[model samples]
Target: MRVDLFDFELPPERIALRPVRPRDSARMLVVEGGAAPFADRRVSDLPSLLRAGDVLVFNDTRVIPAQLEGRRGEASIGATLHKRIDLRRWQAFVRNAKRLKPGDRIDFPQGVTAIAEERHADGSFTLAFGGEEPVEVLLERAGTMPLPPYIAGKRPTDAQDREDYQTMFAREDGAVAAPTAALHFTPELLAALAEAGIASETLTLHVGAGTFLPVKAEDTEAHAMHSEWGRIDAATADRLNAARAAGGRVIAVGTTSLRLLESAAGEDKVIRPFEGDTAIFITPGYRFRAIDGLMTNFHLPKSTLFMLVSALMGLERMQAAYAHAIANEYRFYSYGDSSLLIP
Candidate 1:
């Protein structure tokens, strides 16, 4: 399908710059077959909406404060870690790429320094940190949360965003972006879901900086997905398969969870344990085997994420949904409202 098919008018002012207070206070729009698929509900009502036998799968990957400011000689540079290649090497994007060359030494906070080892064709460079402390620990001291460009313009990340941008279940650290769907879930809400007889499991998928990168391809099919490391453990797989055997639904908490599940699916549609980098691209003709439903935040217009949702909800339906969301003053994007798409 043409990428333009996913295009819709989203008012710039409607983009959410901050999360709603109490997190779960966000709105949820349910799009299921039958009727017009226009239901008004709160995110807090999620537990009650799902059936007893359903299994909720969430991405436990935590966002890192990967955005850092540093100086190369006298030139100041803004850097964001794209992904870690190993203990020391990382692929990163630098703001002043034109002035940076391979073998340039940059000093970070806490006296940590790195040497640019290689330059990629896209202007991103590889950096190898020189330190004994874990790179993550170093980043914690030197970096700030990597907010999307849209949100960054509105305000700087204060104490509120330090907690608000991440999910309550975030554990394994790597993602630069938050799984916005999981942002709406609270500990109390998870407990309520458990009390309602719904089971939950977690998989880790370190969302990459590429997620926010705009699609340069005019045709959707021409686009290539950025690789992000992900894993589904044996325990989670067993529980998910068991849920399927018992005729239970598998509800993915976000697109990250959905992509991980789909990437690890076996021949029988049962997910298996998987640990590797995945660059799986899901466009309109992609058949989903593992996820039954998706819980995701509203996405940008003409984005790959928009295409992924269209694959499940149908392009025309999603276009209509976005129009409704806009007309009703629903918040949009990372810190925005959510939707439950049952395909």
Candidate 2:
């Protein structure tokens, strides 16, 4: 499909500068099958919407403070590490690329330095840090949360983002972006789901910084997906299969979780424990596996995520749903209102 087909006009004011006062208080738009528009509701109403024995799969990868600012002599560079290639090597996006020559040293505030080793065709760089220890340790000491680009002005990382960008079940650290659908759940909400007999399971998909990058290609098929490390352990896989055997629906909490589960499914759509990198791109016409329903945040127009939802609910229906969300004054993008795709 042409990438332009996903384009839509969104008012700048609709961008959610801050999350809702109570996270679960955000609005949720429900789109079932190839249905008419959407039925609007609040996120807190999720428990009532789901049936007993339904398995809600969540991405439990924690967001890291991966945005690092550094300099090469008098030149400034904005650095964001997307993934760890190894213990000492990382793939990163570096701004002011022309100012830094290969082998030039870039220093961070918390005593981290990156030596630019090579540049990729997409303008990102391969960086190698000196010294023997792992880079994860250095990152924990030096980096700041990689906030979405829409957030304006210079600001320090504060108490709120530290909590808001993370999910209640977040455990492993790697993702630069949060699996936003998981953000709607609070400890209280999780308990409520449990009491209601809704089973919860977790998988890890360290969301990559590529989620923020725009689709530069004119055709959807031409767009290359950025691979992110993910895993569904053996135990979680077993429980998910058991839930399905009992006639339970598998509800993915976000596109991240959906992508990981779909990537790990076998021919019969049964999920298996998987540990690897995936660059799976779900566009319209793609067949789904292991996801019966999805709870997710609103997405940007012309984004890969928009295409993922379009794949689930059909393009026209998704367009109408997005239009309804906009007309109804629902917030858009990360840290925004959510939607449930029953289809």
Candidate 3:
């Protein structure tokens, strides 16, 4: 389909610069599969909106401070580490890349340095740290939170972003971007869901910087999704399958979780143990075999995420739902309001 079909005009003011004081206080737009009136709700109302037998799958991948400002000779350079190829090497998108070349040394703050080992066709570089210290340690010494350009361009990343950009379930670190929908969840909301008998499970999908990349493709067929590492253990897969066997709905809390689930699920709709990379590009006309519903943040116009949601709920319905969200002053983007899309 034409990428222009997904385009819409969004007012700039609707982009959320920061999260609400209490995370669960954010607004949620409830969009049902059919022609039901869109419901204005709150994140705290999730328990009430979902049934007792339903399960919510969360992405537990933690956001790393992947943004780095450094210098090579006289040229200033910026890098956002998106993927880990090994213990010491990372795939990063580099700014001022024209000034860099293979084997060039870049010095970052706190005495951290790396060699620009190779440049890929996609314009990213393979950066290998120049110390025995773990890459995670090097990042801690020199990196800042990798905020989405939409937000970072508006304001500088600060100490507050270190806390705000992480979800309650964050544990296994790797992701450059936060699974924004999961950020709306809090301990109180978890307690409520537990009391309501709504089960929660976790999977990992290190959301990469590619999530923030714009879809420059004129058609959906031309868009290539960047691969991200993900994992689903056998125990978790068994539990999810059992839940579905018991007539429970498997609701993915974010597109990250949904994509990983779909990647692991077979044509028969059974989820298996998986630990590898997934570059699943979900678009309209795709068959969803794993998730019964999704909870995610408002996405950018003509973004792959919007296309994923459109696939789940139909293009026209999502377009109308987004129109309602905009008209009602709902927040947009990574730090924006949530939406419960059931299809």
RMSD from true fold, candidate 1: 1.1
Q: Residue-wise lDDT of candidate 3 within 57-153, one digit each (tens)?
A: 9999999999999999999999999999999999999999999999999999999999999999999999999889999988988999999999999
lDDT, candidates in the order shown: 0.89, 0.89, 0.96
In candidate 3, the residue pairs with backbone N, CA or C atoms under 3 Å apart (3 or more residues apart, or in different chains) clash, namely none
The candidate, 2 or 3, that scores higher on lDDT is 3
Model 3: lDDT of residue 144: 99
User: How badly does each model clash, as a count of residue pairs?
Assistant: 0, 0, 0
Q: In model 3, which runs have C-alpha deviations exceeding 4 angstroms?
A: none
Give the candidate number with the greatest TM-score: 3
Query: In model 2, what lDDT does residue 188 have?
Result: 78
Candidate 1's C-alpha lDDT? 0.89
Error of 1 at 2 (Å): 1.9
Q: How much is 202 displaced in model 1, in angstroms?
A: 0.3
Question: How does residue 116 of candidate 3 score in lDDT?
Answer: 98
Q: Between prediction 1 and prediction 2, which has the larger lDDT?
A: 1
The estimated TM-scores of all candidates read: 0.97, 0.96, 0.99
* lDDT for each residue of candidate 1 in 56-133, tens digit (9 for 90 to 100): 999998999999899998999888998999998889988998778999999888897889899987778899999898
Best by lDDT: 3
RMSD of each: 1.1, 1.5, 0.5
lDDT of 2 by residue, 218-334 (tens): 999899999999999999999999999999999999999999999999879889999999999999999987889999988998999999999999898889899999999999877
